[model samples]
Every structure is written in C-alpha cells, then in structure tokens.
Target: MSWTKVVAITGCDSGLGWAIAARAAREGLVTIAGMYNGSDTEAARALKNLCAHPYKLDVTDSKSVTEFQNYVKNVLQENPKYKLYAVVNNAGVMTVGNYEWQTPQMIENMINVNLLGAMRVVSSFLPELRKNGAINDFKPRIINVASHCGLQALPCFGPYSASKAGLLAWTRALHLEHFRDGLSVISFIPGGFIGSSNLTMNQVENGNKMLSHLTEEQKSIYEKRIRTLNKYLGQASNNTRYDSLSNEVIIETFVKALIDNKPKQVYKVEPWRYKFYYNLLKMPFPDIMYYWIIKKFLAFPDSE
Candidate 1:
C-alpha cells in the first residue's frame, strides 16, 4: 500500500510559497498553489511546467476563498483514495510605519492578509482534513509560516512583527485544539531576511505616493518616519543573502515535517547566521534594555 499526499498552499505568487510548492511537487506530492495574481504571475510562470497546479486565490476575498475551497474539495473528494496531508498558510504582506503615521487602510491591509488570511484558509479547509481522519494512512496537518520577528520586538517593522505574533499565538492555541483529533500543527519560523523574496518595497513605494496626498504638516511627519525606516531596512539588506540552500533547506524541513513519524511542534532556523545572534536577543538583562535605550536614542531621543 503506497502512500500519496495531496497538499494545498497559499502565496505561490513568489518567495517561500513558490519554493515550497515547487519542492513539494518535485517530491511527488499533488500540490495545489494559490496565487492572487492568477496563473500569469512571474512566480506561476516559472513553475508552470513544474508539477504544481497554480490556482488563482486572493486570501482577502471571501468569494475567492470559497471558490478555491470548492476546488480543493472537489479534487480531494473525486480522489477519495488519496490522503490530503498539508496546507501551508504562506500568503502575507508587510507594512512599515509609525502607529501614528499609518493610515487606516494600511493597518487593515496588513492585518487582513497576514493574520486574518491564515485563519480563513484554515477554517475553510478543516472539514476536508477532518474527513480524511478515518483512513489508516491519513494524517492531516497544518503548517503556519511565521517569523522570528514574531518572537522579538523589531524596532521599525511593527505591522509585520505583530502579524507574525498573532500567527504564533493562533498556531499554538489551535495546535492544542486539534492534537487529539488526529491532526498535527506546526509553526515554521524562519529567522533573518532571505533573498529571492519581495522586500516590502511596495509598502515603501506606496508611502511615497501617499506623501503627495498628505497635508504639509502630515507630510513632514511622514517623511521623517519614512527616512528612519528606509535606513533600517537598507542596513538589514547588507546582512541577509539567500542561497539555493536557504530555499531548499526550508522546503526540506517542510517535507520532513509533513512526513515525519514524530514531527516537531516548531521549526526555527536562521539560514545566514554566523553566530547565534537570535539567541543574543533572548538574553535576559539590561543587555537588551541598554540596546533598546541606545536604539531609541538613535531613533528619536528628542521625542522622549
């Protein structure tokens, strides 16, 4: 009795989503990848000849989500003999702004696509997962893609960090709920910025556009905040680089988590760390307190 796993993933338009779907298909899983940009996205085009199926889905839209859910249900139902193993909640967006500087729409977009989207996908797909539990080989699982920023308080990247924090909390709570029901939940947290991914440049670009629409006083405040963020993100860029191993390595972890006889509750790795810098963040002390105090000094001591 051979085993075949069918999988569904979101955010296949690029980055980790593209890498995960491509690797899963390469490893012989039936992979259905959801992309907001439909099949014509560059990420979809690159993987079009690959074994994965790129379906159009905007996680923020209830109608589109419902349609994709139906598509997955039909595919799984019509092939009842196969096991539906994993769904990777990988779709998300990032926004950079001081709380006072951010617009209502920007806040809503970040919260919707990053936090709400994950829950929406999980809620939509659970019935199909629950249906597979009776089969001997069936082991349904959910993997939420979170970030190290979720664990730490990043200075300038507030919305992204908050979203990941929400995801981490959600993953932890949901794991408890589904553990006894024959389902597995894992949170995959990747540390540091990886190359070959969208660098939140869209948010920066949008901020610049919005600057023209603001009143003179509002524009002045936004410009200063934007400069602060631009400098920080630029500095971080010099430290992070992604090699093929970063993508392959993370995907390999995903594959192992999917099939492991005893999968881990959480997977955390920094593909480019020369030392345990992330560990240093966990250091109890005035070490972190002093660092933040100095960072605040550099950022805006006058405001204090």
Candidate 2:
C-alpha cells in the first residue's frame, strides 16, 4: 500500500484554522484538527462530518500537548501506512491597546500561546516528524502561522507583534537547524483578516481590563486614547475593506507553503497596499515617514 499523508493543525476552533483544516481534508490528506474548545463546539462537529479527526488540544498546557502527541502516535501505530506529513502551528490570540495599557497577563498570554505554544507543539512532534521523514524518504513541513505585524510592529499591537516576531525568529532558526534532515520549516503571514477571524473579538473586554488597572490620573490621561484605539480596532475588525482576501485566498497560500517542492522561508498573503507599504519601508526612508503613515492608517490618537 502507498503511504498516506497526515497533517495536524492547531486552533481548529475557528477562523483560518477551521478553513485550513477543511481545505486540507479536501486535498486528500488525513487531517488531525486540534480544537481548544474540544468536541462540543459546532466547529468540532463540522470537522467530524468532514471525516477529520478533531481532538481537544490546549497548546498552552504541556500535559495537553503531550496527550495530543500520544494521540498522534496512536494514529500512526494503528495505521502503519499513515505518515505525518506536516504540522500547522495556527493557534494564536491577539489584543489591541498601547504598550503601557496592556496588563502583564495580556502580554504573557500572547507570548505563551503565539510563541511558546508553537514551540511546545513543534518540540513535542519533531521527533515523530523527523522519524517519519527519514523512514518515508519524504520531507515534512512545519508551517507557522505568523503575522505581518511581526515584520513591522504596530502601535496598539505591542504584545501581539512581539509574540509573532519571536515566532518568526524561531521559524528561521528551526528551518536552518533541520534543513539537512529533510524537514521544511517556514512561516506564513495570513495578512489582514480582521473581519473574518476572532483575533480582535475581545478588544472591548481587553480595553476595559486595561482601563481598570490605571490610576485616576492615568485614566484621565489615557481614557480617551484607549477608547479611540478600541473604536478603531472594532471598526477594522468589522470592515471588509480592511480584510481584502477571502478565506479561500489565504488558504491557497497556506496550501502552497505545505506542498511546494521548494518552499520559501516565508509565505506572506497580504494586500497590494500592504505589499507596497512594506516594500517602501525597506527603502532608504526616514522613521518619521513610516510612523506618519502608520498613524494615519491605524487612526492613532494624537499625543498630548
């Protein structure tokens, strides 16, 4: 019998993770979806209907990751033909606020999930992936779902940006470390999908939490700015104009990163405007121009 390719994806509860999981199943790969919310949700039911294996996975918990790893090991043991082909580190969370406004827990949560979580999953599964690659004489890819904010930090996305930047750096280092082992590690920036994803779903809640931590004097100074930031974030999350590409478009780039014979170190799916702006930043430009453009684009409140 021929080898059957299998893929594991995290954050299958919603958004890009759900879309990508569905697409991967349709592509004839045996998909194992890791849903944080477990099998109770509509997404889990839908994935089950698709014949994809959906399991409760909490990347933040070491025990949960180990359990998920064991589950994958069982699948391989049960189906000898099955070879772990790829692992998609898609689990991530985000919040919006100025750096000072963000709480310690908020920053820690982003780092724990976006950066350390991916690291945990990768470290847990690398042995299996490397073993499969060696035995099957085929390369297995590790696709990290990164963000454009990682490339250029935005004002209200301090923690989120830092997390993604760390993820990207780790991706680069891992890619080099395992290149000769027939393991492909890369980062995929899904670009601006604010309208479609649950990334900024808790903007208001986060804003409230941030505001509660401030002194009365601090609150008087920062309340308007925080409110402005929250309003802008809400609008951006709801506005289709801010998110140009459909889920299908984003997943197509993801598929390319998964199946390409010579995949790039980074696969970025972004709008033309973002492409232009990012390119412009690469040129010999002044810092003021870049910040000015960002201030206008994100509707940042004026400093006192």
Candidate 3:
C-alpha cells in the first residue's frame, strides 16, 4: 500500500466504474478514471475531489486510447517506483430486444462499446505493464468487468451477453497468453448490486430512437415486443446495482479481482439462486435444445 500503484479504470461516468474509481482512490492508489463525457458531468465533479483523476477517453477511438497510453507513461516517468498496476475495462453498453429485431447500426454500436472498446483500451495500455512486472516481481493486471449473463441464459439481453461472452473468452486467452510475462488477466462476473445499477431511462430513450429505424412492416411485427422488453430491462438494469440499499459495497468483486495476487480466472458474485442456473448451463444438454427449451418456456411467445 505504501508503494506507488496506478490503476486506470474506464466508464467512471457511473455504475461500477465510478464506484471502483472512488474506492481505489480511497485505498490510496493513483486511480485514473476514463470518462467519455466532457468535464461538466457529475462523474467528473464527484471523482475530481477524490483519488480518481478523470481522463477523457473514448475507448473506441485509436487517438483517444493512444493519448491515454501516453498519459500513463508520463505518470510513470515522474517517479521510478510508479507502475501502471491495472486497467479495469468497465465501460459497456446494452441494448434490449430480440436479436433478430436489432438493426445493423444497433448491433455495431453495442459491440463497438462493449467488446471492441475493451480491446482497444487493453491494447493501448499493455506497454505500461512492462515496468510493473519488473517491480518486486509483481504482475500488472487487467480486470475485465463482465456479467453473469456470459455464464448462462440471459434471455432478451442477448447482444449484451454476447459481448460479455467474448470478453470472458478474451480474458481467459490473455491470462494464458501472458502467464510467462507476469501479466494477470481476469474476468469479474457480477450478479447484482445493492444500489441503482446502470440501465435506466437513458437506454429506454435510445431504444425509442432505434424504433424510428424500423420499417413500417417491421414495426408492426416487433414494435410492441421491443418496447416491452426495453421497459423491463430498464427496471432490471437499475435494480441490479442493489438489492435494498444504494452503496458502493457492490464494487467488492472488482476490488478482489484487482488486488488478489492469484485472482480467479472468473470471479463471480451473484444471488443464491444463480448457482442452480450456472450449473444448469454446464450440464450435458445440447445448446440448441437448451435454448429451444428456454425460449419455449422461460420466454414469452413472440408477437405475431
């Protein structure tokens, strides 16, 4: 704790990112918070007074990510003991609807933010990890903020789940690929939280905008279901941050993923009932059959 350790965390505008950045700063680590918005946002204001230094970073942009890498390098050069200890890829986006109902633009937007965005950040900051491993034989880490949906049947949250699944796979690959380099990569699969989660009216508003993209025929077929799904997801996403109270306790799994010397490849913290489903996904049942059964029973009938 006495040594200089820098932790860069993306998506600090809200939800898990803000909580983690705030918590890291409290723990005395140099926390760099990556935010997509300009300095006027509440996240910028709240994190400004703490250990977190909000940096403008659009993980999807090469120029932005390059700038972030330069920033980390400059920070490390200020002191020989300073190391870029970790980069928490926490920025993500979610769209709610049937997969077939999603427009090409919607699909691209989701992936660009959720999957490629994480990839861009990791690729950009990897060089700074070099100095970290040389210090006290310590390994720099990459903690990817994934979801339990990557582990099971997340239903209407398909696109978002797909992105997380890729993240899970990518994390595992990095863990293996960089083992000899003393770089630790892990995935944190969150179940739910005790405060207001990320999904909210903002996505509902975005979903409404996408509705305009549908053809008249398509709208007649999928409009009702899409609206219903978005409303349900808005409630579900916000509720995931907390079971009853609004607090930063939900960021514990993230902290564990970062500080543990030998972190689990996938650190999970969810509800009691998720265990059964988690096991269910791993059973010998064929994926096709399992999905079919899930759609037939667990999901409501699609609108004609």
Q: Using lDDT as the measure, which candidate wins?
A: 2
- The models' CA-based lDDT, in order, is 0.73, 0.86, 0.75
What TM-score quantifies how close candidate 2 is to the native fold?
Answer: 0.92
**Worst ten in a row by lDDT for model 1:** 236-245
For model 3 the local lDDT of residue 153 reads 41
For model 3, give the 10-residue run with minimal summed lDDT.
239-248
Candidate ranking under lDDT, highest first, comes to 2, 3, 1
Q: What would the per-residue lDDT of candidate 3 be over residues 61-93, giving only the tens digit for each residue?
A: 889988887877787788777778999998887
Candidate 2 runs further than 4 Å off = 235-245, 283-286, 299-304
List residue ranges in candidate 3 displaced over 4 A: 193-195, 234-249, 281-304
Report the number of the highest-TM-score candidate: 2
Better of 2 and 3 by lDDT: 2
Each model's total of backbone clashes = 0, 0, 8
Query: Scored by Cα lDDT, where does model 3 land?
Result: 0.75
Which stretch of 10 consecutive residues in model 2 shows the poorest summed lDDT? Answer: 237-246
TM-scores of the candidates in the order shown = 0.84, 0.92, 0.85
